[model samples]
Target: MPGFVHLHVHTQYSLLDGAIRLDPLIQKAVGFGMDAVAITDHGTMFGTIEFSEKCQKAGLRPIIGMEAYVAPRTLADRTAQDNKELRHLILLAETDEGYRNLCKLASIAQLQGFYYKPRIDKAVLQAHHEGLIAFSACLHGEIPRLILSGNLKAAEDAARWYLALFGEERFYLEVQHNGIPEQTTVNEALFDIADRLSIPLVATNDCHYLEARDVKAHDVLLCIQTGKTIHDSERMKFRTDQLYFKSPEEMTAFFGHRPHTIENTAKIAARCQVDLGFKGYHFPRYNPPGEERSAEEIFEEQVRSGFEDKWRIILQKNPDAERSRYLERLDYEIRVIQEMGFSGYFLIVSDFIRYAKTNGIPVGPGRGSAAGSLVAYCLSITDLDPLVHGLLFERFLNPARKSMPDIDVDFCINGRESVYKYVVDRYGGGEYVSQIITFGKLMTRAVIRDVGRALGIPLKEVDAIAKMVPEVLNISLENALKQEPRLAEMAQSKPEIGELIDICKVLEGLPRHASTHAAGVVIS
Candidate 1:
């Protein structure tokens, strides 16, 4: 049988929807003799970097992509009457330009187009379609929905529109054989459209888990996602168990008659070549207000000026304070920061902290290794004197580390928004600034409680089971089962207890939801 790539694979990063982890997914792909896999996680590219790096190490090509939600009208439109429906589209980056465009589209969806889900409209897609390969995604995709609604002309028009935008070589009519009754009808219609428009058809499995037996575990994950019981008839569920990652032979079994469709998966995977340019310095440019001096010059000037002011107060507090030692430390730090290409970073942090203090917004003196920097103390970014406390500046900004220095700042909850606004406005506005995204996963104890609740288990029993999982940080379910003999014995003695533990074990560590990082923000 000819080799086939699983282009619609989702990993744990899909956030409670996908049950497959990257390690097992990579293992399965290699074991199946396939050379590539695609991660089309719903509405986010959270897993792309990890996926790309891991796949390259394992000698498998990672096609970085997202299963994006498209709005019915303009992305900005939000109304109860006319704009509730969302369409799915799979977008893959074919080059560095495509990767950038894909990132732009995802950010626009997140910052501007969010409603029930992050979404984009055709207008934005058209504006940023360069170097991208688009696919009419699963059953939820635009063309499939149009075909299902008995509007062949609209479906054809939609296909042609994408074809014209991405160019014929970059667009494909993606078909899946998941055994959903609608998919059979959708695939037939897609084939008819593909023949008429001369557009190629590509087959994918829309994989959500790793294997056939994992279907039940994935179902439990869906229950946790929807807050529904496995016994609930109306809860959201997959219609078929065919959503697991299938081997090339298995996929060929599903689409044996259409060899070209199977072959198209490899073709698409080979075409997508994205270089994320990892480990490059990406600090935002910080130009001082109305000053023609370079960042290095401005940084040194502020450090020396602030040091003199700080030293004067130090002399008043302690008449024996050594001015030369302070000056020497300040000069050393400035040189290190300048040589490391981090002068702008220090200036940016100092600017915001200064703004906070000037405006009566409470700020933490400093925290972590950042307190070890004399530059931080001079700039008022920290309150502690490294010399008095015997702190090492190299601990904060070691040249040997060869990574960006981290400085953690704390601000009054009520006034932090103002500080953020000041930075945004000072930099370039929302276009150049955004908050970082963080994921909350289903930890061991929390997963037990959640699974028990979804299973309709009594609160007392569920709480007892959850408490049995040791209160250690980031403990896994398997470890908990082994560490607590009572838990393992209960699992063996009682079937319901065994079932509850079983489900929780599989659902643990998958991302439960996404939220903005509390203290971190990204600036372009």
Candidate 2:
């Protein structure tokens, strides 16, 4: 198998736009004894941190990167209120500095350069290229377009310019073979250019879907993206079914004639040592004026003052009940949080929630575990007082079950960004806060549908068969066949149908994608 590691890979975080799921990719990499794998999702680094952790857990190295669009100018100009097409390049973060640069580059592209695609120009690249690796990516790259136009010399010059921009050792010329005629031509010219510049060569599968069978499902995705039906004459199409995560044996067979290309993958992984540690606090902290006090102290002052204010309002509103009960509950809850070593946690939560209320972000009263805390209610961290709402304090911060207090605050969807920004601007740096990363897995139904399409089956039939499968998390084909009388009857009635169903049932539920989870944040 040589030293092959998948470099240009995508996961579901490419958002229904890519096919490779997580479990199988990790399994394949670990099973094959492959050292590392990279996920360069189109235009986003959303999967970078999640992929990093999963690969590490799987004992496979994860290279964090993104396949970013190269804008024609600075980010703001490109994403102005106009549609535009731009060249693409692959960027991999080789270190933490590289990861930060990648995040900044991606943020700028989306925030400023997002007219048609998130893009950045040469100026952005030159500024953010530190600790990063670059590749003259797929046929969509500037260099590949030049080569295809039969301007080899100009392509060579373009290659040199990229090398200069990203540093000679940091840049490589990519060669992919999806059985496209133009790819072969591009490969030949790229090889020639690589030799001239003495830059390394990397082999990638450009895996948009997981298996050969997914070619058609991906085609369907292309249709979905273009708002065209399968039968539309102008629908976009891939040149080959070869754009899948081929097994090491299949890849070995495909490029067995050229060992150097395959070996280059391992070489690149060895050089890419980006360590993504789980940084703490998804929320940024509020800094007090003139360094007058630490975040912790300031937070405590706010919580105590807020608690007193809220307590006065509550007692005045309800003068009938014995005050001892409320006082006793508060004492118990505060003691539990203090013993759990999460008073700071309470302080942090109270601070931002108070800020949100002050700034007019409509926060949910309280949700999930935080609904039961008397301290939370007193501090205005939750609108519903536990006793008043018939909620048990143990449901939130259980004395018997010591764990981090789960305080989830929901804000209006439109203002979540400002809330998140407030958190970032106040809390994090080298020590305080960063985004929590997540991974989405490729499951059975998608793999089955994707595989069926790649084999070039009729769309109506595939859609019908898929519909027979229930719309639940990880629904099984066996269950679908059993539950769907028509599907079982079709399998029994038609031989080809039986084989197709059998093949898909087996391939279903394998890793299909990697994506961020909505509304889940973790702090460490």
Candidate 3:
């Protein structure tokens, strides 16, 4: 049997569409005796870092990739009458440059090309195609779609275009056997195109789940994603049970007649090598107007200047204010920040917060552990004085913690965009400054209601069942069943109820969707 690698795979990071969790994915890959696995989460790279770390720890190669959405036209074209044609494409990072290019593509798709999905046009692809390997993806890929539409000529043209763009060695014609009849048809035409163009044929399962037994739960996940009942005949469905991660032996057997299909996957896996080398801080550079001094120098100067103003306020509030004590605390905090190489971080936060205040944008004094920092108070990043409030600066930024300082500032709803705009303008363009992406997981209560709905349970009954899960942070269905015996009784008494809870257990904590984090922003 030829060795096969899963070059097209999805994890829970693919949101509601995929059911494979990362930890189990690693375990299964090791158990299957595979040396490498790929994570091609749909239109996103949210799981790349975590996947890479876990795979490395498990002694397997992690091929960081994305199943990208390609727009038929320009990213900016969103006219109502326009086709807004979208197709799937698989992209793998073969080098650090490839990883960087993948990041650019993901960001551009989200920031500029987002329509029904985050998308990129061929123009952007032509520019960012370097250091990346291209696969025609599953049946939803451009070439396959064209072939299915009886445009074999067009499909061949698309194949040639990708061949030229990614070069002979970097491009491959992807074939999959997901038990979908179209896949068989698509593979036949894909083989012809590969032969005519001298491109290689690679096989993938287009795995959405970990095992065959996971098909039902994964199907319910799709139902939850589409907000449809499983009984609905017209509901979107995978139409096959074969979209599960298969072992090398199983894949080799499936493509026995075309052994090279199995061999090419291993070849691709061997060629893919991406190291993110995540270490150290790349803080945004902050320079005070007309000051050539280092961030540390400027940071101290600004803190002291601002402290003088704060001192006057303190003296007014309490005539017996301990100036020496306050100064000592401020010195300690500044020293810690400077020594930790976070002076630029402090300056950057201070600059934006100051901008919000000067521009009459209502800003919260400060919140969270950041309110405990004397440096923040003196810098005007916070209004509450740590000494007066008896707050420990160690809670915010400690010398021993060796972590980035997190300062949470609340801006008025109407003016939040202005603050973000100011930060981007001051630090760099949109490429350097972007909001952080966050995932919303399927928690206990939500999952119960979602699974119940997809199972065609009445709304009132679903609501009652979901409420029994208890209102707690990060509770699980099993815990809910244990905590509330009445819920467990219902699950035991009714076959449907037991099924709903069983499915919910499989999906709980899986990411349901992705959205921008309200306050989290990355500047580098």
**Segments in model 3 whose C-alpha atoms lie over 4 Å from true places:** 1-3, 56-59, 73-85, 149-151, 288-290, 307-333, 356-374, 383-401, 410-418
TM-score to true structure, per model: 0.91, 0.76, 0.87
The 10 consecutive residues of candidate 3 with the worst lDDT sum are 77-86
Q: Mind giving the per-residue lDDT tens digits that candidate 3 earns over 33-68?
A: 899999999999989989999999999999999999
Please give the range of 10 consecutive residues that has the lowest summed lDDT in model 1.
76-85
Among all candidates shown, the one with the greatest lDDT:
3
The digit string of per-residue lDDT tens for model 1 on 165-215 reads 888878999888887999999999999989999998888988999989888
Could you tally the backbone clashes for each prediction? Answer: 0, 25, 0
lDDT of 2 at 410: 87
| lDDT of each residue in 56-143, candidate 2, tens digit only | 8888888888998886555556344323447789998887798889988997786667766777778888889898998889998889
Off-target runs (Cα >4 Å) in candidate 1 are 1-3, 30-34, 56-59, 73-85, 314-328
Model 1 clash tally?
Answer: 0
Q: Is candidate 1 or candidate 2 better by TM-score?
A: 1
Give candidate 1's whole-model lDDT. Answer: 0.88
True-structure lDDT of candidate 2: 0.74
